[model samples]
Target: MKFSPHAWAKLIYLRDRGTTEVGGFGITDPGQPRFVKDIVLVSQSCTEITVAFDDTAVADFFDDQIDAGRHPEQFARIWIHTHPGRSAEPSGVDHETFARVFGNCDWAVMFILARNGATYAELKRTGNPHSEPLSVGIDFRDEFAGSNQAVWEGEYLRCVQAAPMPPIWDLDLLPGDEPYLSEQWPWLPI
Candidate 1:
């Protein structure tokens, strides 16, 4: 799939903005649904390993896009997200979320961009057990808008809340230590 220069730059900026993962929706060209012309980010809580969009924010985004006269194909089919690590491979969590959330759509794309510039994109269609892998690239031929850091930064700050995931292990405790495990996980009776 192709991204407009403007969208590509914005994605790169968003990916490098912080340590946590970030996600957004790609706005496609009306006549060319596979060509992402822009991007719109929704409010979300993000950690190093995950990004969860706010349901209300997502609904509002749909409303706003509808009000703007854009169809769902133009705004909702492409799920764009970043990987804070080097690998662009989707995790188990990503697979679960993609199937649970976007599986109902006629067609959808899950796109991941890693910090090392590695990318992974897969297109899923209803009734198809196998997904198609797509090549990602920047399309510079289009007359794209320039990046507005002020606007992008504002959107990033307003939409993304960096909620760090707690470490699974306490450095002071060994694997056999029960006390630390019990303290760390109060819900579990260790």
Candidate 2:
């Protein structure tokens, strides 16, 4: 998939700015949903290996985007995230979350950017549970906006809540207790 230069730079900056994973939705051109023009982050809690987006924050993002006259296809179809490690390969959690969360949509894209500059992208569509691999690249041909570090930093600070992975003992759950993980990562199956 093609990303505008500004969006590509922003994703790289966000990826390098932290040791934990960070995720956001891609804003694409209305006419060309595969061509991402920007990235919009929602409030989320992050550990080294996981990123849990806040449901309320996602709702607010939808409302704000609609108010601005953008369609859902423009703002919600592409999921962009960073992998803090060298491999951009999707982990089991990533696969499960992608399937459960974006499965119902007519089409969607999941893109991963890694710290070591590796990347992975795939497109999923209704009726096709199997994802089609996509090439990732920056589209410099577009008249892209320059990076705005201050704004990006502000957004990162406002939306990303980095947290340590809770130890197993710290969970303190009895056998019959509801799975706490399902709550923190609502998109994952219990």
Candidate 3:
């Protein structure tokens, strides 16, 4: 599934913000770094994808959006967020999170960014034990201004010009529970 222009903009915006913080989303605890989970992108074309954050702020953002009535169906949830020292591939924590949440949705999107600015995005289908890397290709019509650069799927370059961003979903809160997916990433078995 390809991301829309608007969604790409949001991902870039969040990436910029994440660049400043050690792990992203402002969690400074050494043992409790930030992560994202349960994200959704409702696009007019293709499948409306949901991104699940292994990180807390990402999840909270979705909750806020839902409270604001942005996403009504909450059809699919994509799991996304950054990996500070690792690649964008799903970790053990990611596997466990997917196992627990995969039953609720049809797709998953994962965004991994290194500390030095290298980034990668992945889209996964439910019940699929693996996450596929999304090849990102950038197109620049004007060489002088880097702002005009457009990102596209490397495999399908002509599709569009865009980037990736964090998405929020409208999910209902279960009773008597704090959000299981929190900003502080509690390491769980895959």
- For all predicted structures, in order, the TM-scores are 0.87, 0.87, 0.38
Once superposed on the true structure, which residue ranges of model 3 sit more than 4 Å away at CA? 1-63, 67-69, 72-76, 127-131, 137-190
Clashes of each: 0, 0, 27
- How many pairs in model 2 have backbone atoms within 3 A of each other, for residues 3 or more apart or on separate chains, i.e. clashes? 0
- List model 3 lDDT by residue over 1-190, tens digit each: 3333433444454434322211222111122111221223221111111133334544665576667664422322443344433234444444555557554556554455443445656656667767676665332232322232233122112211133322232222211112222322233211
lDDT of 2 at 37: 88
Per-residue lDDT of candidate 2, residues 6-54 (tens digit): 9988998888888888999999877998998899899999875678899
lDDT of 2 at 156: 96
Kindly report which residue stretches of model 2 are placed more than 4 angstroms away from their true locations once superposed: 166-190
Among residues 3 or more apart in sequence or in different chains, the pairs in candidate 1 whose N, CA or C atoms overlap within 3 Å are none
lDDT of 1 by residue, 1-190 (tens): 9999989899998999999889999999689988998889999999866789999999999999999999999999999999877777776677878889899999999999989899999999999999999999999986768789888899999999998674654222222234423544444344
Give me candidate 3's TM-score against the actual structure: 0.38
Highest-lDDT candidate: 1
The lDDT for every candidate, in the order shown, is: 0.85, 0.83, 0.36
Over 4 Å off, model 1: 166-190
Candidate 3, residue 92: the lDDT equals 45
Q: lDDT score, residue 162, model 1?
A: 97
